[model samples]
Target: MGIKGLTKLIGDNAPRAINTNEIHSLFGRKIAIDASMCIYQLLVAVRVGADNLTNDEGEVTSHLNGLFYRTIRLLEIGIKPVYVFDGAPPTMKSGELTKRAEAKKAAEEAAKKAREEGDLEMAEKFSRRVNRVTPAMIDSCKRLVRAMGVPAVEAPCEAEAQCAELVKNGDLFATASEDMDSLTFGTSRLIRYLWAGTASTASKKGIKPTEFALDVVLQDLDLTLPQFIDLCILCGCDYVDGIKGVGVVKALNLIRKHGDLQKVVDTLKKEKSYTVPDPYPVEVLRQMFVEPIVTPAKDVVLKWKRPDVNAIKKLMIEENQFDSAKIENGIKRLLAAKQKTSQVRVDSFFKRATAPNEAERAAKRKAVAETNKKSKKSKTQKSSTSTKGRAAKAKKDVT
Candidate 1:
């Protein structure tokens, strides 16, 4: 859905461009999140076996549960989350839109068949595939977010594009999305896997969230941003078909050899085995990625304030039938995150300049030292194991 093979290409070729860090390290940070992606993730995760989270009226509450809990987790960890929702799709994306709709229809049919066969697990999986973020769900999320005093932005087009814009404009510290195309959108910082669950959960599962910087990737690949976008198009993007026989590796080679899209197309034409699409909208797609429509920087307002407890309780408890104890605990945690800092300001949602007192600074320094010491020990153990394996292999060869 995102630049088709971009993530894999980067993973295999430029591993050092990715950075891994803990949730605790992101305290006092403001991140712009792709709201639709989070909703879809939550809807699927809340569905277990043959049961979907629903209230007494039989309306699905999975989306609400996921959104509420995940947002609370972010707040509890001292991270301010700005949710961004998508608007009208770009005209060029009509083909991709049709493809997604067809896939959803197929998934729905498969789920029905699985249910008829009493295969609950497969049915559940397929059901999740058919999950769509509906208008009602979006409204509910918006209400919940407002009640929690968090900011929500409605993007002019793609949410990822808007999030990237926010990061570029310095309105947000980073953009949080799983989409690889966010990188192509030129977001300075992109954090992956911050949806449906807490970052700590990912860490515990040994699948830590990765933070990607646009500059680092550019440095590693030695390509300008415009050239990188061309490389993505060559690999395959939402708007265009990839050249036949050209995978991510070949695409990168072509881009590296030829600095421009026109040149790349010319090179492909010379090759007897491949053909470029006639009148390919390659330039249009490149421009769309480079200059996506987004809300003006000055129009965005990020503010955090005391949550409306009674309103949140009514929506979750009386309407959605969520556990009172759990909701209360989440609210308590939000309050705890607030108490850690001296001032919570509306204008500076993404920045905190408070200087730590001597005692707090000393404790932080000690904690950092311990962490570094443990890291050193872990590296030493791995090195020792590698040396021992090589020695054993040598002895076997001698024998």
Candidate 2:
């Protein structure tokens, strides 16, 4: 279930719902973060009461501020975060993208018309809004993240799926995302309420927030990982959008009875007499869920580098016109956490270095570099071969 549904079900009692003590027991664990998801939350939250946040030179500072603060919080919690950014979205998501573009275009036009009609206030309000995710903006965020010592993964398509795969393979403990879709996507651990403790909330005795554990979900559904994927398809997901009239409850029941999707489909056709036009081409969804790209060399590390306090103060207090005190406090908290984490990492590194000899270390380094070189060469060769094949096919078509 998504956050909306889960929140509704638990209400104020949500916090008491999950064993946070046990969850924190898994602290210092590596988390594969859906970077775009966190970015979206930052954008929306920061822009809630304003159209745009401008820096001293009148540049947009909303995205930057959001990225800066949230990243600090994640690091403060002692969680090693591997940020995964979206690349070109998969082909099936084109329709959703097109709809988003149209909506943005319509809003822009309305804003323009409001300005022409002398409705300055409305025009200004609409003009300050933004939702489109651009390649350039994503690149800028990636650069900032890298400079901060956060390792980033460039996912070919769905970042959440790749993150989920990382967790499944035990490379990561969990995938951190606000979107509950990660559960359906096959992540073993999906922790919601990541920002729970730091933020304010109304007290409701006996109510607890919950982190929907995958094992519990799987046991409840009585389905294996692949079977759960089948169930999600029934419940409607990005690949299928959804089946008409089939919701979470009904989808669960359908899957439980049929044992698998094909049988479920056959039963629907025969018993219900419903012609289910292939919900989505199964092959496409399979390709979409292909194994994530994993780095063979785990040299990549996440460390908390100290924030440039003067730079942050200038950006937040002077430029953005935020309260100086709040900005200072936030920076102080961030710096303290950074110092602690850095010391731990440094100590661990030196300890490991002391254990290995110079010759052994050199040999290990050489082997890794050669392996990476071979991988790159093979990828280039494959790309060249594919291009030649396409050219040959075009020539034959011309004939």
Candidate 3:
């Protein structure tokens, strides 16, 4: 849903954009989490044979279960999490939202067909695709997050954009989300796999938890902030439809060569046959990403209070029907984590996570690159031999 193929584009063009950091290294950092994204993840994770975890009366409670434990886990490790919820979809993003709704409908039908055919596995697969983070789910997640002492903030616009605003205001260090939208929204540091030791939406694709610094990405790709936003739009974003055939690489090249969207459109007109959107809404889409409407930096208040043990218990055990002992155990963990981070000797709770080691990380990256290079070379040699053998056989046939 983020700028399509933006991750791949960054990997290919801006290697310096990425920095590998372990979950343990983030022991005491304040991270702004995309709450709705995590709820969608739980819908996929805490399921019973493709169906969600539900309380009595057929109400979905997987999100509650997931947030309760995951929030505990974050606190246990010394990370101060501020869960940010999406406010309203921008007018420009209505089209993308509509497309997602239709896709969910199609997935629902496909899931039904799979179930009728006795393909439980396929049914579950399609069902996961169909599952959405409903309004009820969002409210429940916020309730659980706040009960755990984490601040739950509802953004005036996109959650990622608000998280970016928080980071810029120095209220938080980074935005932790599965999608590259945080970077597009101008988050200074975008951390994928915040829960990688547990999971991100990226965990489904086996993506490693990595960090992307916007400044580094811009410097490495030689792109201005505006140019980066334009490139994202050309590649397709949630706000506007992209050109039919212009992919990430093409978008990057166009932005690099022409300087802006107007010039890119003019050149595409003269140069080649490319299908641009009819009502491109270039300025509208660009502004949406470039200068998103977020709650004013000062107006947003983030406070991590003491975990309300009784409030958490009432929701998890009474309302949601979670195991009483398990809910209590999680609370104990939250308390223990506050006193002292589980695996580290930290003097303070709020600033517990340790910074990453640059030297060791760079060395490990070099070794990985070398190993991959060797593996690729080996495959190419084997492919060359196979081709030669096929050619020799073809010659003998001719003879």
Candidate 4:
């Protein structure tokens, strides 16, 4: 909200916005990913291209193919991605999921109805195209991810929120998610376009060469971490649907002046007779954004531990009928790359581990110090200018 220009750049080309050179700097970075989010994206892509993806056994291979290729790419890039999967849907989000399920059910029913009306081909196509996230499917994917040596965490609630909490606490350098709500959730680093390949180049203008620090954002918005949450609510985040007639620009302006949600709500209510709709219950939003379930802290071990080539080959080539030559080449290339660049030093991965809560507090203190310094300098300059202006006025009066 503080920078409309940056948001526009992101929208223009999310993948191309990130510079590859910057990625090298993050070679050893611990990236916490919302596993469900990534899997959902893959699922959608695969479902759309279902006709083209099949194994020798004539079984659909879209999910497995996407997982293998993407995981390989991430490992090749030297990113230590810890994937957090959703354990169970949050109580508040049940309505959203139920709504989706109802939509899918209606679609299926319509397809069936169409079949009865003699539209058999269309019905068959629609039946094959429905995307569902089942418990069994989630478990299967988790096993695959673990097999690939990516640490997988099962989050009790919102996976993205838990990942954000990890980033906030410095256990993770950034939370990789498409949602900008991570910023409001108080992640020190929220990286979009993480899996975009060359598409990250598009984010070059929006993001600085170095990671965009949370302190920089807070200063730019003239708000605290909590106030930033309020601003996001104003901008229509999930916790609270944004206020009517408030866009990004308007939301930023309101929050910068008021510095809190209640004040902003009161100001708008007085000015526009806006009976502020409670976006969600205040408690719910607070809990969702301010407090997230964090996994126990542990020392990060960053290494390009080789994949089990024999197992991968067995799964992809022997069972799935993947091109044996291609699988062999990919494995060979991965091993060679690992050998060429074996050691990586992650800045945040230290010998000692700190509790997630302690790390967050430390981050907050550092942010506050930087903010205070900036504010003090601004105040000093203003006061100095005021004194000079008064002295000049007195001299003019004496003359």
TM-score versus the correct structure, for each prediction:
0.82, 0.66, 0.83, 0.68
CA-only RMSD, every prediction: 12.9, 20.1, 11.4, 7.8
lDDT of 4 by residue, 1-399 (tens): 122233542333233323334555666667887777676656556544224366776665566666766666666666677887876655666655666678878877877787889887777566654566567557656666665556777777777777776776667778887666666667776676665541234355444223444555654444667876776666665444556677777777787687677777767777764556754465566666777655434533333345677777777778778798887887776565454344567554466433234356558768999999999999999999999999999999999
Model 2: lDDT of residue 235: 58
lDDT of 3 by residue, 347-390 (tens): 44455343234455457667999999999999999999999999
For each predicted model, how many residue pairs clash, with residues at least 3 apart or on different chains? Answer: 0, 10, 4, 15
**Comparing 1 and 2 on TM-score, the stronger one:** 1
**Which candidate comes out best when scored by TM-score?**
3
Model 3 stretches with alpha carbons more than 4 Å out = 199-208, 341-399
Q: How many collisions between residues are there in candidate 4?
A: 15
Question: What TM-score should be assigned to candidate 4?
Answer: 0.68
Ranking by TM-score: 3, 1, 4, 2
Cα lDDT of candidate 2 equals: 0.62
Local accuracy of candidate 2 as per-residue lDDT tens digits, 50-100? 355656666555666677666666667665668888766666777666766
lDDT of 1 at 292: 84
TM-score of 2: 0.66
